[model samples]
Target: MNTILVTGGTGYVGSWIVKGLLDKAYTVRLTVRDKDNTAKFENLRQIALTTKGKLEIWEADLLEEGSFDDAALGCDAILHVASPFTLRFKDAQRDLLDPAIKGTRNVLYAASKSGTVKKVILTSSVAAIHGDTKDMTEQGLTEFNEEQFNQSSSLTHQPYSFSKVEAEKEAWRIAQAQDEWKLVVINPSFVMGPSLSSLSNSESLNFMKDILSGKYAMGAPAIMFGFVDVRDVAKAHILALENENSQGRHLLAERTIDVLEYAQLIEKAFPQKFKLPKKHAAKFLLLMVGWMFKLSSQFIKRNVGYPLRLNASKSREALGLDYIPLEQTVKDMVTQMLDDKLI
Candidate 1:
């Protein structure tokens, strides 16, 4: 459990996990799609130079089979955190499902092949647990938990959610078939915080940018979303790796808030600093004009006006997680983006 292989080490969430592991003096091997792009991981490399942890960069592709075999050699654990998370895609199966599902299968296959690997942590999103906020009412549950599986998303509807569900399911299938290694899933809600690198194209960053840059100045959809700090999510992953009792799935979220509440929090933190949305647009208006915002009518109907709730007792009880307040999360993230001139 000393040497760990981390996929998607350059990503927003993965970078934090890698930094946490590096800070703890663990031998962390990070897999990237391209090793030649030194700037993508220059910050991590500099951190590794200062920290006790050893960092190695290996080039691997999610779409290619046997790509992770070399990187997984002699590794005690694998942290599979790489997956596509964009909303706009031309082909759902090729752009989302294949990379996510096949990527999980390939990474786990490497772990099974590696005799040294005894544990694996997969970064699955809350999207996998439930597709739409409307699902909360339809399923007869007030809050979401680890036991629920997303059943509403498909190739045409919320394809990103569909990809995560299929990917996690594939991981579980492989984990069940093998007896050598154990699988732990970390399902996090809308993660937001100051990313270690400013070059991330994560939807979380884009969402904030859209709000601050006046893309939603007129109004934003009053969508309820579960929020969690990116740093907290990263810590949960490392905690899951270190704690033997951490098994199965753990839901990681701080609290639930609507988009208007989020804007209010931002306004409270920095009064009149940016052109913020004054109110939530009507759901009916969103259903008609959501296409301009890249939201389909079905998306608006299913998620725009629903309340999203999640029970994170397992994370607190099992991982000893004390969530960061939503106010601080919003402030820190906005400050970082502003300092970096990203928005």
Candidate 2:
């Protein structure tokens, strides 16, 4: 597509997609919550100046209906990448679910009404596939694939995952009712890499900061999860848009590793003394004290000490994505955080 509408274009994963689209000379209409906040999108604007692509900033709110109508109109394609990833929330429905489900509805509605948008790529998450690590064995599957939908997440447990699942479902419901626009879902695991905007406050970056800042030095919960590079995730979105044959959901994950193994990767990349967790915290210990870390007992019981695995063959074969190694991903992210004084 020559002209595209990208929601959350200034976000962590969305920024990378915007960069790739600009590099390919596509006119990108970026929708933000506030177009007046130039600093939030200055990095993207600077990149736009050097590329052949045109960048247009528009103000829109995810919670408001029809907010994306003006920005999405006349766009050849739409990349719905804006969604909250925070785990901390006072109200699950208001903080996470509303923005996610409503945002998906609004974006897809805009695309459907635009009459020009033929392709829509929704940025879902692996959290939508399986709620917790234990779901793998419980479901009698070796690894999670495109066919699965998370069944364990609820309003009180892993609310973030619940929001993603509901949002993705809403996208599918909207996409099915109409044939004018085809929907492609990109379900990426924990996205990690250097962000284009240093001021970006993503949960992925916060997870890294927690590790390097000694919050988990004593011991990290033995939580295993999938990891993927932000760049790779962005590439998947573009590939989905470019390849007409691409259909259904594409799971984008490089590999699976536990908290302790992640620390080891960091140590291997840095080789410098940082308060990296040397070992996994005992499950019982975590169960007793998990509340101190804002971890629900149900979350700790279901996720801790369980291995998370996924089958990303579709992303590789269909999207032709060669995933980045976790070591390099960790190195680049740590280096950027250091430069930004975030860690």
Candidate 3:
């Protein structure tokens, strides 16, 4: 009976969120840039056919004003998950910052005007919490939580992190200025697992592909991250939408592990298909590779050999979330990648 507006319904995470909502019998009004792309909405259609919920598609663009107005109307909630994510950017401002910040503003503005909208579930990244691994120690942050924000990132340091921080900050600012809608943000770390659609554009999928394809054959960087399953992340979004107690930021990571450990898990799970990197590359070599690949140089200097610690007890207790293990996530992701021939 309740209809929710889901932006980026065709995306990696958005697809799963749409499926979860439909499975719960929620009428989903999905916003996509192109309404004519039947293939993009095919998965949702199939899911809707089997579920009790109904699905509607709308044309909306983040950069264009009033584009989401129709979709937001008469909706019970808005799930704003549409944002550009890229590790390699030709122009940071145009590619990442503008769309992320402006898109949040557009969606919130639409929600503010919609009298039926009561809450907004935003998909923010862990990058919004800490800019660099060094900041974790420099700022005396033993572990990252919902309270800490990324202050060290700028357009120069880590543009993607900076974009997430600024966008989330803007969401808080907009929510403060109005009482029409409550805001709930989910800050997920590196999200992995089987994607509902076969798309492999997400950075996590790319990383998994590289690992399976032997791109990291020589060795892997010592970088560590708190990982969560894509399904759990979507479940968190839906739980936050339904639970009145859910408020503020929720760090949705299940566990933390190093890159090599992740690869070893994949190898152990599927020894015949996955050949993981046995050697660990030197920090300096990773730095050189970062330079050659034109990646964020800060990725090497700050995070390549560092351990990232995140405290997710609050999310578990508040959201009643049972996160799937990182090993299972990696195994599922690797299996999917192999089936799709992405490796």
C-alpha RMSD of each candidate structure in angstroms: 0.8, 0.9, 1.3
Per-residue accuracy of model 2 over 152-229 as CA lDDT, tens digit each: 999988899999999999999999999989999999999999988879889999989888888888898999888999
- Candidate 3, RMSD to the unseen true structure: 1.3
Per-prediction TM-score to the true structure, in the order listed:
0.99, 0.98, 0.97
Model 1: residues with Cα > 4 Å off, grouped in runs: none
Candidate 1, residues 1-343: lDDT per residue as tens digits? 7999999989999999999999999999999888899999999999899889999999999999999999998999999999998986899999999999999999999999888899999999999999999999999998999999999999999999999999999999999998999999999999998988989999999999888888888897888998999999999999999998889998888999888788989999999998989999988888888888998888888988787889999999999999999899999999999899898
Evaluation by lDDT, superior candidate among 1 and 3: 1
Candidate ordering by TM-score (highest first): 1, 2, 3
Looking at model 2, the pairs that clash are: none
Candidate 3 ranges beyond 4 A from true positions = none
- Per-residue error (Å), model 1, residue 326: 1.4
The Cα RMSD in angstroms, rounded to one decimal, for candidate 1 relative to the true structure is 0.8
